[model samples]
Target: STIAERRPERIAGLVYLCALLQPSGATPADLHRHDPDSALVAAIEMAPDGSATSIRPDAAAELFYGDCRPEDVRTAIERLVPEPIGPAMSTIDTSAERWGSVPRAYVRCDRDRAIVPAEQDRMIAEVGVDVVVEMASSHSPFLSQPDALAAALVEIRDGTA
Candidate 1:
């Protein structure tokens, strides 16, 4: 769904989840799933429409499990779950918030399909992210650009970026 189309509660909730995914095996794909340990999935369960959630895997699990399909975890999770909104739900207001106070530093994958630069730009701007470094690669930057991604991490740790 378009970010603009989602209810405010959902939007605000997603921000918190993004922060959660940042630390918990936050590969590009991991940040977008419905894992039990995932902050995003937690937020979803708390959402009014989330009572129908059935296959929740812990976000920080070493490996994925349960009845979740690849599509259910990342791209079309809401589609996979049942809805409680009845015929129609009200649009959410603008009270969204992410779960972060620190600045963000990224090892971007220039060729990423799941997450593009435009979307990342918006996310960083909204989250007040302070550092960003891009690299040529696919959605899985660690796999496609490990050395560059690693260097960026070192920079983030050393406060050099």
Candidate 2:
């Protein structure tokens, strides 16, 4: 059963699935042809300030914020925090009832190397969002193009988009 099927309650407001990589009925391995582990930064040690630190800074930059500047990448790495990547989060619910009734928008990052444009397109097509906004940014648009992201969010919030 899907969330919608189980809950059967309409969402009060809009939902934003930004830079989504995996669509319904797909996995991260489906997007990356090769071993996904190889692309991951091997040593993500925790800093004294409780922030995540990457030993392979270059690789992390390329993976997370490919469109960001060198200085921005350094700042992002320094401020990075640990995040959970659980199996349930990666899994997508294809049930129409749960997702179809909700108002949703997608923010596509064109230069996102982590998710890639093709995968993003697949999700947009499969899930079917109310609005589609494009940004010339990497995976981490919040760091690369925060202003644009904020504008899009505002538009969605105001229902003017």
Candidate 3:
């Protein structure tokens, strides 16, 4: 979204997959704070220096890949790494003439624990999109429902979603 907003002329459309879709001037952290049902914030472990955050490995499966295969979950957990706090907390800057003019779409995950369904709906309502596709998958749909995810992406790319 930020990239599109910054260089709308370079991109054709925007497709967010169970992502933090905030309005201008609002950070992703801001949206996560309002989602009381989301389990992601609670599972996050901040570094002592507060420069990074990590999800507890034990909680990873439930929060990110609830519907994924056990093997996939194990693989993902093995590759887990601390995420820098700066980007996650950065506020998005957009304008009606740029971001708003670009066609936007969202692929919502109904079983997501990371972003939660209500939070996803809130974001869709807060920032209107040209398309909204729902899936019976978790936050990590790539691991849980790759086929469906791919199909949705294809439809979005084809402008038929």
**Top lDDT model:** 3
Best by TM-score: 3
Q: Which 10 consecutive residues of model 3 have the lowest summed lDDT?
A: 32-41
TM-score (C-alpha, index-matched) for candidate 1: 0.40
Candidate 1 backbone collisions, by pair: 8-92, 12-96, 36-57, 37-58, 37-59, 38-59
Per-residue lDDT tens digits for candidate 1, residues 1-161, read 12423333343212111122233223433434423344433433433544443334334121221223454335433334544532122322221233342344555555543444455554556434456666665444443345776777777767786
Off by over 4 Å in 3: none
Q: What lDDT, from 0 to 1, does candidate 3 have? A: 0.90
Off by over 4 Å in 2: 1-10, 13-18, 21-57, 79-85, 88-94
**How would you encode candidate 2's per-residue C-alpha lDDT over 1-161 as one tens digit per residue?**
14543464755444443444355676543544433454542434445664334345556777787878889988987876555444423655556656566667778878876666676787678657788878888778888788888998888878887
Angstrom error at residue 93, model 1: 14
Clashes of 2: 0
Q: Which of candidates 2 and 3 reaches a greater TM-score?
A: 3
Residue-pair clashes per prediction, in order, are: 6, 0, 0
Query: Any residue pairs clashing in model 3, and if so which?
Result: none
User: Cα RMSD to native, each candidate?
Assistant: 13.0, 5.5, 1.0
lDDT of 3 at 153: 93
TM-score, candidate number 2: 0.66
